[model samples]
Target chain A: MVTLIQRILRGNPTLFFVYVILFVFFVFAASTAPQFRTVYNISNLLRQAVAFGIVGIGQTIVILSGGIDLSVGSLISLAACLTSGIMIGNPTLVFPIVFLVLGIGVLVGLTNGTLVAYLRVPPFIATLAMSAILQGSVLLYTKKPVGGVTRGFMFFANGQLGAIPFAFVFWVILLSFFLFLLRRTGLGLHVYAIGGNQEIARLSGIRVSVAKVAVYVISGFMAALTGLFLASRLGIGDPLMGQGFELESITAVLIGGTSLAGGKGGIEGTIAGVLIIALINNILNLLGVSGFWQWIIKGIVVIVVVAAYKVKE
Target chain B: MLVALFVVAGIVSPIFYRPQNIFNVLQQASALGVVSVGQTLVILSGGIDLSIASIMATSCVFAAALMAGKNSMVIPITLFCLAIGALAGFLNGIITTRRNAPPFIVTLGTALIFQGIRFVYTKGAPFGSIPSWLRFLGRGGIGFVPASVIIFLFLALVMEAILQRSAYGRKIYAVGDNKVAALYSGINVPNIILSVYALSGIFAAFGGLVLAGYLGFGDNWAGKGYELDAIAAVVVGGTSLAGGEGGMGGTVVGVLLITILSNIVLLAGLPYQFQQIVKGLVVAAAVIFYSFVKVSGERR
Candidate 1:
């Protein structure tokens, strides 16, 4: 039991930092605002975390396989636009629209995968270029925001089950799926093998390129889901809706103890990381810091957290 | 050559390659070229400074806030903004090199923080006025060229010299090429990385000022999406994003390529959507060719 405890402590210590930050934020939130304990407020926070958490799942897969996806945000915007068109037109279309959105997401992911795997394009540049294309496409397709009677979509999106938001359920479902994929399957082991040593994985016949493609596709799917979620929540789809989400999703993944170098993260850490970020955003709101100052603080913390994690490693 | 494509367009339309149009291309490229200089430095060291856009945005906001007048605060505040940018980069370096974070993650985190700071300062909406004294810097020019463009060129040349001709430049290449080998040679690799990022920060901040001045106003999003553009420019210019190779000269070409394409596409009356498709194809093609060249060269 002692050895197991030590193993847990030694194997992953980012949780400690997360705990500390969580504690600090909790106290800060309580002290700064008397209404920090409202059920509505707490649910709001979880719902918000759902966005980053779900997207981070896809991000985690890509990062675990030694890649990054900057195009996730733009994918989100596109997905939201596509799905909203169908769902807002009639509630009956929601189910079909979800698949359509996912399909679009998969296509985007495959494009990224093809470039990274077959052509050997650098992940950063490839995804970055993809993002630009996606953003520009979003702007060109829908010149302005698409607003209508999206109450059905928004109702389902914002609905809560026993204080757990509907989006939170979606996040949980994704987490369960990825967790299974990462633990029970040969694919999981192969991802680790590739991330740790690409040449050896290829030698082992792990189909490294296919794996790379799969992860990016998963990322695209998640990004699309998030975009759709944002649309449902916003009751409209804005062309520039997911403008800076690439940075945020990437940040969450990093903060979750996933190494940007790839092959070094997990779902649990990502969940924690998402909450940590959500908490930070909530506290900033509570503190009423200038949005600019809040940005500065978040940047400093991310830099510091990443640096600290590396130092320990 | 893409130049042939440009020439064909010029032939098809008489004013396509006119001096005025080409100058417009140069003007557009100038701002990105300035920021790309810094990006070039960080990449050369095998580090990615993703927070560059945030730093640029921060500088834009601060510079606009300080555009109260050409009082004693002008020069000092300008210096302060530059220093802050360099300092932000320094912070990025410490985490990346000293603290052991991947440069990508460290910068990514800082990018968020800086973005938040911009939002907070502006309170979801930032409105400001540029002082009359600095209007010339932002709008006026010496003869025909924009003062901003001139500054962009000057910075690019200076940075190119520093990267290619200077001892520090050599060190940066050495570290990027092989940190273990560099450290064995007793090079302070971490310090060098820090310095390069710091320098990158300064360039980003400088670019922010140019962006603000040229636009004659500043906002939290002034440099929005610029980091990606600068990165694309550097890569298209034939600078290996892998580091330890390429320089400002190539980046200049890349920036010009993008700027010119942006202009020419508009001139061709291609809608923005098709223009994006074209841009993506061009970048995709560039990446494929670049990969082919690098991969083949490595084999040989």
Candidate 2:
């Protein structure tokens, strides 16, 4: 058993351990809470994980390219603010507003990428500035929550087909698409290469700048998507919507085994990471723990998970 | 450029020349100025401390909780708050250095932890006014000079002298410039990094003290979002984000510049929202401007 465990550890250091811990937590939660065994709760858990999971996908791409996007949460707020502010329960405005939000996402992503790839600004600093700008703009636009979400918008988030929520379906679709892109595409290969060694990747004839730029653009789009879903669910656009989401996504990515320095890890790990977080949150809510305590627990979990990986290394 | 800004402020709003306004700017700048000093040191050592705001917030809450509106509790409560801040920094440094973790993530995590503690302690609502002494430190002036400004200037000068003339200061720069090279030269790189983070925590705590005093009370919401302001000031001061290329003098100028710009915006009667946009733009522009200058210099 020891030898088998050692072999599995050698084969993939990050994935297996995090998975085991996740499985353990799942079992523990399932046993402790009777509601945890219900189909309703399971679907709810998956639904809760969707947004962070989606954002985590984008974060995985960026981290794989040796960059981080702190602006994602703010992008989410921007998307929520813009979409709900414009749509205002008008079904006719939905399509145009969606396009506008995506366009803004692309624009912000392009600017972020250009700063990092072309101007040599550190990814953290560039995205930090971008986040500040996005957040400040959103706050400037609306000092309070703007309500006017359409029934259709709410349905998009809260609706389900048969036994499954649309959110879960959306998360699955995003998961499959990104997993394929990361595992099967040339762009994914180059991303890993650049993250592993930027100079080597450049010397090896990869268009490092293009890959970096593309990843950030994808990240922005995903964040916008998350924002849209968030607005739909809340039935309002809040300037503070998606506050601290960047950290949450990063925590999920890190828990999933993605390295901050980049090159290693993928979406599968992030999916599991998101599930772990969702489960913990679910359990806390079930136990009636306060949000403040939840924060402490989440913070400690991040440190512990990171430290665990460090120990293995 | 800073002088130009001051002159522009005078031209734009006659209130800018008012003694009260000047004192307000000075007092306002001092809180940020103290935090920026420690941020400069942390960045100088090739590290970033995202927890400064959290530390400040936590210290403010801690001090307030302990004092519970009592004057005699001031000194002891202040020391306790500072100690907690230092302890938090020490933990951050240890985790980052020993585990080879990214300073950003580690500090980010620690920030959450500190924030969590504060929230749990305050239960989302903090009460208790500050002591009269602290209130004076926060708001009172001796003659035309604000007490906060005096404290800020005194700390800034001391830090500047240390960074210039102290051996420890040079070691910090050396470590930041190139850790491997510094390690080889036996400059104790880890300790320097650790101490810088500790100092950042202490300074942020001090800043929180001033802020608490300024408000004359403590609240859970105090010191929220000051991290970006401090970082913006440091960067605008011409300090490289990559570290090892800035000083306290530059940070002071950056702090003043930010304060004055906000003052101008307010004096010009712009909405508060514009200030956020401007701050975001200023940080981005400052970094871009510096990077372009560096690129041109390299080519030459």
Q: Which consecutive 10 residues in model 1 chain B have the weakest lDDT in total?
A: B129-138
Poorest lDDT segment (10 consecutive residues) of candidate 2 chain B: B217-226
| Interface RMSD, every prediction, one decimal place | 3.2, 2.4
| Tens digit of per-residue lDDT, candidate 1, span A1-313 | 9887678779777765665666787788877787667888888888889888878889888888888898988888877776665565676777788788888899999999999999988887788779878878887777777644256778656987776787888778879989999988988887777777799999988999999898889899889888888888777787778866777777777777777666777777788788888888887786676666766776676666666555343
User: Across residues B155-231, which tens digit of lDDT does each residue of candidate 1 receive?
Assistant: 88887898888888899999888888988999999899999999989988878877776676768778776777777
Per-residue CA lDDT of model 2 for A79-161, tens digit only, reads 99888898888999888888888889888889999989998888888898889888878987887888568998788788998
Docking class of 2: medium
Residue pairs that clash (backbone atoms under 3 angstroms), model 2: none
Cα misplacement distance, residue B188 of candidate 1 (Å): 1.8
Q: Count the backbone clashes (under 3 Å) in each candidate.
A: 16, 0
- How well is each residue in B132-151 modelled by candidate 2, as lDDT tens digits? 88888899999999999899
Query: Which candidate leads the pack in TM-score?
Result: 2
User: For candidate 2 chain A, which ten residues in a row score worst on lDDT?
Assistant: A304-313
RMSD of 2: 1.9
